[model samples]
Each structure stands twice: as C-alpha cells, then as structure tokens.
Target: MQGIATQLKETPEGQISLTDPDARSMATYGKGTGLVGYNVQTAVDTVTHLIVAHDVTNIVHDRAQLAPMAKMAKAALQAESLNAIAD
Candidate 1:
C-alpha cells in the first residue's frame, strides 16, 4: 500500500480522507459518476462482538446492505446458517 500511496501522491489522482491512510479504497456502488469510496459492513457476536467476516463493498444505498450485513454476521457467529432482518 505504501507503493500505491506513493504513486497516487505522485500522480494527478484526487484524494479523499479515509479512516486510515493504509486502508484500501474502493469505488462504492451507486448511481454517482466518478470516483467514490465504498461502505464496508461487518457484523459480530452478541457476546463477544468480534468481527467474523467482512465485505469490501461500495454500496451507497443502505437498502442493499441488509443481506450482506447479515451474511457477515452469520460468518462471524459461525452458525450453520441464519436469517437477518434489517431496517
């Protein structure tokens, strides 16, 4: 990532403020045109709240985040399978 950051800094690419400079930035899913950041989702257990699996995505609409969020939650919980409901 250092190499990529150095290259981006040396080029004409625009920059956006990220939570971490070393974190990977991906184009988020939406109708917008041009460069955008992705909104990643993660889920954890009720007891431990430890992150299991995470999805790297650029979904701008909260509406579409449900299944992915639930899936991540299930993975974290290590359940054979589960159902998720989001509002």
Candidate 2:
C-alpha cells in the first residue's frame, strides 16, 4: 500500500481511511483521543425535534460547519432567512 501511503502523506492532514475514503480522523473531547469516521451534521426542528437537514463531511472541526449547515437547513425549510444555533 505504498501508493496509498504516499497519497496520504501528500495530504495536508496526513491521514487516510482505506475502507471509506470519505471518512477522516476526528479529535475527541478527551485529551489524546481520536476516532476515525465521517462527521455527520444534522439540523432539527426546535418544536418537533425532527431532523430537517443533514450532511456528511470529512471536516474534523465544527467551526466551519455552522454557516453551511444553517444554509442547508434554511434551504430545506424553503425560508428566506433562518435563525440557527450550533453548540
């Protein structure tokens, strides 16, 4: 798997998932812990608690996801504007 290793080394994150290329390593809340999986983002209705929108991404952090997830939720709801909160 030298080719795979080479490719992974070339990536900015220096990570590779053989089973699923879309999956990536994610840091955990605990120190020095991590997991390899897809980062799933979901938007739920405040009242109904039903999932309104969802997205699967390889991004390791949530900082950049707020706007995109909010936009997806807004589009799914067919709204002109949306008020969203992310934790």
Write candidate 1's Cα lDDT for 1-87 as tens digits: 896677678644445345554343454466544444666666655566676666765444567777778876776676898756454
Model 2 clash tally?
0
* TM-score against truth, every candidate: 0.44, 0.84
**Runs off by more than 4 Å, candidate 1:** 1-35, 81-87
lDDT of 2 by residue, 1-87 (tens): 899889988988888888877789899899988999988999987877889999888999888998988988888888898789988
Off by over 4 Å in 2: 1-4
| Model 1 RMSD, rounded to 1 decimal | 7.9
Residue 14 alpha-carbon offset, candidate 2, angstroms: 0.8
- What CA root-mean-square deviation does each model show from the true structure? 7.9, 1.7
Each model's lDDT: 0.61, 0.88
Model 2, residue 63: C-alpha shift (Å): 0.8
- Top candidate on TM-score is 2
Model 1, residue 27: what's the lDDT?
Answer: 45
